[model samples]
Target: MTAQLANVAAVHADEPSMPGIVPATLARIKVELLGFIRNPQSLVFTVSLPLLLMLIFGSVFSGPVEGTDVDFRQVFISGIIAAGAMSTAFSGLTISVVIEREHGIIRRMASSPMPKSAYFIGKVLMVLITTVLEVALLLLVAVLLFQLDLPATAALWGTFIWVLLLGTAACTMAGFAYCALIPNAKSAAAVTTPPFMILQFISGVFYPFHMLPGWMQTIASVFPLAPMTRGFRHVFLPDTFKAVEAGGVWNLQGIVVTLVAWIILGTFLTAITFKWRGPRVR
Candidate 1:
């Protein structure tokens, strides 16, 4: 992706007087956005799946958390917000790329006269837009049905922003790297769904992290999603809720470190392994 962007930059440098680059980028973005919004499969992944999970979990656990005053509904809402972002940013993006590759859309785009960087930027922007909307929908539902309160302080909102942005970046890069694993678009769902579902269960999205066995918690901690959910909990839940977390404390430092590390690792892996050709062509 960086190489593609560099090629674009070189082209722009050579044609410094070109006045249509901005318009071209915007045109690409508009086209991609329209395609996404019109696709029912995209809507299911980006909108319905997360909202359904949020509704189910929030309704099922409609009480204060055991041994704490914090409401379980609130905890589920916070966790599901993170999970929704993962659904849209990581799983959603990965599967879309796989299908596009299978259908030769990516290959066609590569052969097009459009700037690769513009296409790449347009896709990334679409991911950001969809993920934000997914989170917003979850929050709106939580507020209306469960009466979730908005975070009041600057620090809380600041932490929420950091976690959301960092988590999205980490997950998006990781999704790109994951594309190398899908041998065909047919197997994309088979490969992607199990891991994401398992992560959600073990990483405290479906239950409290501490309830899992110590070894399982340790394993979950190695992944970005677990820390991402924890970060959300820290900002949204009361400080006392940390008592039940894996370390019995809010590990903001660990959250930041793990997410940043994953972002870098994912970027490196993506640059090395991402394939432009689909399985049939390869």
Candidate 2:
């Protein structure tokens, strides 16, 4: 009995204690979030672009978007929300990382004993934090500054939040994908941003999906941001709102499909392409 007990104790001791997922991830995230928050450029992206869009569309285009009867406030707000989430995830981090790689941050980190997973997890956690903050900030401004109304259904807010989280995750994966595939850090801003900005504009972030031209709408509908924004609008907007034209047929389903497909594709690409080190930077 004593020998058996001793063996059991040894085995129990050898076993990993609860895997430490939450605590370790939280600690790593705290560090990353601290760095991210302090970064001037990161703060600007996570806050500025969304604010700019909100002010531009909210103030200038107060009337209906070209393609739909949806009020600019109703249709455009959700898209800006989605855009804010995207800006936080990919724009801030990706460009910064490219500079980091050019500056030898990646090489130095590689030389150290840091785990690649830790770096990834940290960035992911940081993205999550920023996304949440960005959403809150935008919403606060939308409410207090723009006097935007609360959602019609309470459940819609929850759905909106979920879509935002997933959208942010998709963008983070996108950022990782870029870091791995884009050869040099020097050109990171030049190449990655145009597609992202276009994705936002064409995908209905600044306007209603119905406003997009036929080909552009087709492309945007299948992509991530438009679907997310449309879904988000569905949850919050009123039943009387004409923006629900694509509800069962195109709106909600499109959101789910786009998010799932992009998430899978982005994650796969992110995994295969990501690298911590490379040729010496000039």
Candidate 3:
């Protein structure tokens, strides 16, 4: 008994200390990024599809918005950028988590020595990085092809960064929570895509917010995408274009509040619902 105890103590002394949360998260981020790079089809769907939509819509609606000097293409570009971010964060994350759970990868990871929070942090960070890339690509195209204007002031630029981060975080957390509803990988798209599509349409991505029916506009206001779209527009569109916004003003406070609320709710839901194993697992 004494020899066995001594041997166990020696083995414990030889084992390296586990990394801190930040380091573990960063390492996990690297792994997630490498996995994403290897999956070219994810890039095609997550990035390419949005770019295609931007080109089609931007070209189709090249004229100025009705009653405002702001170009419709500019509005479309900002709206699509917001929608694309949500797509990468919410839809993409949900599908990925569902598939991982279904494949037993999540279960294996849960049993691993790595910090459990690292897995979720890595997933959300991966989505944020992809979202940034998507937004940059979309903005580059908008600037080159549609002549969309960049944010004029440092303050506007600051707004852009915060809005992007907060919106992405809210969507990421929501994705984690929503994935619990998915029964398996096969139904991921069926469960996630329709609501995303509907949000885009109602949240002023496909049409101007002011133009949507009052009921639809009110419904869209309850979701993160509408406020996110409006926030993006505040950065890109001219002040005069505020006339076209839901309240005829740039309600920055409302946008921030809505996003923060969603983030809180999503975090709570994720804590309760998230499971390492698939729903069918015993």
Every model: Cα RMSD to truth: 6.3, 5.1, 1.9
* Model 3 worst lDDT window (10 residues): 58-67
* TM-score per candidate, chains pooled: 0.88, 0.83, 0.94
lDDT of 1 by residue, 34-115 (tens): 9888998778767898799887777777777777888878877787888888887788889988998888888877776666
lDDT of 3: 0.90
TM-score of 2: 0.83
Is candidate 1 or 3 superior in lDDT?
Answer: 3
How does each model score on lDDT? Answer: 0.84, 0.73, 0.90
Regions of model 1 farther than 4 Å from truth: 1-24
Per-residue CA lDDT of candidate 3, range 90-207, in tens?
9988998899898888898787777899998898889989899999999999899988899999999999999999999999999999998888999999999999999999998999
lDDT of 2 by residue, 16-67 (tens): 5543556656666887777776888768866787888797778777775455
Error of 3 at 280 (Å): 5.3
